[model samples]
Target: MADTLLTAELDETHTAPTFAELGVREEIVRALGEIGIERTFAIQELTLPLALAGEDLIGQARTGMGKTFGFGVPLLHRIATADTGTTPLDGTPRALIIVPTRELCIQVTQDLDNASKYLKNHQGQLRVLSIYGGRPYESQIAALRSGVDVVVGTPGRLMDLADQGHLILGKVGVLVLDEADEMLDLGFLPDIERILGMVPTQRQTMLFSATMPGPIITLARTFLSRPTHIRAEEPHDSAIHDRTEQFVYRAHALDKSELVARILQADTRGATMIFTRTKRTAQKVADDLAERGFSVGAVHGDLGQIAREKALTKFRKGGIDVLVATDVAARGIDIDDVTHVINYQCPEDEKTYVHRIGRTGRAGRAGVAITLIDWDELNRWAGIDKALGLGIAEPVETYSRSPHLYAELGIPEGVTGTVRKAKVERDEDAVVVERPARAPRKRNRRRTRAGEALDQTEINSTDGGAVATSSDSAAPVDNAGTDDADENGDKPARRRRRRRKPAGEGDAAADNSAAVNGAADDNAEVRVTADNGGHDAETADQPARRRRRRRKPAGENGAENGNGVAAEAAATTTAATASV
Candidate 1:
């Protein structure tokens, strides 16, 4: 029952003493007063009467505008005031509230719990428990086993607990869809439908969301039976609050931390929240702020639930003046006096921009919202501006330490880093490799060993000289140029040389060397010497008698010579015949 600085007074134009005056039981009024909530927001004023009378209700209001109580109060009131004689035979819940976020579950549950204080013995007999991921199941299971009159949870968790036999909804008399638009945006409509099917057909359903977008409207058409529609538009759609002034600044990424420090030096109203796109950015921003000696906390998905909750609690309790968070953490954060919301980086879309600014200027409380847009984010802002109908396509150029920005936000002028000192040694020692070090220079070191010599081969094998006529077949009619042309063109590129076959047992060199030393006869020596790369005089000098012997008895005497030479000769002759 702590006093809520965040809650706004009831909208007097609609009605005074609304919920209680609208034929709601005195018990419900006393329950709300126990929680120090004596007034109703516009959403609640419009929807309470119909919903309390068991009529279906649809409430439309932007986020952070007290839609939780719009449906939560009536639903809980119905559960508490229901007849005890009609106990649900199946042990199913009498009321169900489905929200998009786990944080919203806690939020809606708090409101429901506050409303349940007047029922019976005040043991919180409403059996209210929040079911969501990132927590163990045993507590929720035990709560359901013991019996809960109402369940507030996300779609997935609700369906999961229901299917596991931990939660029964057949007797559910009231179903509330909080943030129905968000559920559709997250593609959870099918899951919501399945949960709806589990509830009794004869039920009073309430759908409350910031928008009655097409999907949500269609959902109401199918699920709700003649529900009355209510919409509460924000007082100022695109303008800064009366207490809030807008400061658009363009700053270099490197100078942003310094600028934030300067802003902190100015008079800060209450707790401040900075929004960053990424978890790492959130942590970095928080660290930067904390190093400046500011009490800061960071909440994002990367942190464990306990740490996130602790940070949120510290922020709520005023232990921390600044909170850095990712977009996900900022959702369903129902803090009212979050004096300011700073967008460290421009959000990706208009919807995100709306939600981020919605954190402040909540529940009729005036608050400030500032956005720091880099040069590259200009195009992104263009799209967002068009979507939100903001004609200012360009943001004023700003530096982290702009005097105008300081004046606008009521920050002190000419104040440098007062809270956190910049780490001089750390910045000097920081190793920031802009790009990967140029891959090690690979030197092509050429070396020739003493024994391993390089081949002194000519690039072009042909001499460009006239073809020469030799004793055999006109010296093979040199066709080197023709070979080069076939492979490439007329370009004088180096042609790959054909390697000489190694000397084998049947090589001509072996025969020539053997014959020269008188190991073979004159005919074999003359025939071997008549091959390539040797003196023509040696072939001619062979006796005419050797020539006649070389031609005589080509088959018979060659075979008789033995030594496998005749076998080699026969194989060569057969190859030549096959070619022919």
Candidate 2:
């Protein structure tokens, strides 16, 4: 049965129905006409009536099949047409939309806001607010305190506001869980359950997803009341599948960037999207492409909310030619002008592959999807091939410089990895858009030896004294002159050793008396002070002596100093013998 459903053909000869024909209100019909949207897609045609009739429903469709309006149109209509007697006008929300990501929250909020241009609830004109993380809480709180008819937000932020008493869900008449499968994948089921418990049980609930997995079915059974399951089946030769030309090739991992750079230079390529499996890979690919002279942007989880929004704005306005993103961040990105999509790495499953490629060939436009498979990811690609029934079970082996790649992809002859020089110059000289700068960080001051020296200079200058300019002046030494005697009643010698003169001549007189006391074992106190006589002169001369020693050449002065110390000890022995 599933196989039959998957292979079913859609009749192209049948005319598409308009929004007004589906019982949509005149105000919404006018809004749609203003945006030049007159015809309804298959999903909208099937689910709009059921949803507007206040029936619990599940609408299943592909990712880019106009599901937003299928549910959005009815969601707005129900709030506008609700009875005023029961519905409260006391600044409380009437409808709630819960999604899994901040990007999807913003997308859905914008779509709903555009659709509700001329819409009104029982209170007054309809107002919508998008509440998500990375935005300040005060603004959301103020918007709720004022009036809001609809609220679209992620589960975590919604619950946070609800717990803080800033959000009230009791009066919510319509609840929607968009992208239910993604929410389940992100582990938001517990928060979803708690949110469901907060809202009134008698309200109408709607669930929509690209694929109805077992968990989604169970979730629907638990929350939705006897819901009607509707699947918008596309023809096996659907426009999206037919218009896109897909090529799968086994590529070397190290050479993938070079291949992507060449593909971006294809004659038919316009704005392109490169999908990777991880955030790190996405950023790396974007950087590599930028170096190749293509204006590129990156959308990933690591970027701040402001940065992500800025990149998306640039891509939408044609400021950047390429966007690299992860699967999670690329959800709900509906850009119709994207002419090419490249899979930098193999997707994990069939659903992911479909969604990644769906970013292009949208709105009936032709596109190209290229998948590069590594040696390790062959098994993963094979599963996708089998599930999609694509005839290529084994992809063709291709290299970065292969001749067939250029011919098949319509690349100009003689083009290499780098973009043309003229194009590079033009892009380099283009005007750059600047974003607001972040605040400057405060740095801590650390103390070092050099800093201590400077501090000493400042202190001496303040005290009206000559400032010591080198670190050796601060070297610590024993203050033996302040003590009169040692433990044995003999004073410690404080004579300064001279490197230029012989040590025997400089200190023989002081050593003679000291030797006499030592040999006689007498209790007399002998004070061997420096030739400079006092502490003040000794302290002043210490730095000069150290400077002289450091200035001496290492060749002869080093040996001379060693020999002088031995000669001084011998002279002291000779003096002791003379005293005996």
Tens-place lDDT per residue, model 2, 1-580, is 1121212134688687899998899999999898878898777888887788887888787777788898889988887877322365456888899988888888888888888999865567789899999989999999999889889999999999999999999899889999998899889999999999999988888898987889888888899888888777753433235678999989999999989988999999999999999999999999888888889999998999999989888998999989999986557788888999999999998888888898888766888999999999999999998888877778888988999899999988887888743533457768999999988985533224554543433333222222224533432334422222244422222234332333355354444444433333222123232333222333463421111112233444333344344434534544554443
- In model 1, which runs have C-alpha deviations exceeding 4 angstroms? 1-15, 83-92, 121-124, 234-244, 418-580
Global CA lDDT computed for model 1: 0.68
TM-score of 2: 0.73
| Best model number under lDDT | 2
Cα distance off (Å), candidate 1, residue 149: 1.4
Q: Go through the candidates in order and give the C-alpha RMSD of each one to the true structure.
A: 16.2, 13.1
Report the error of model 1 at residue 6, Å: 26
Strongest candidate by TM-score: 2
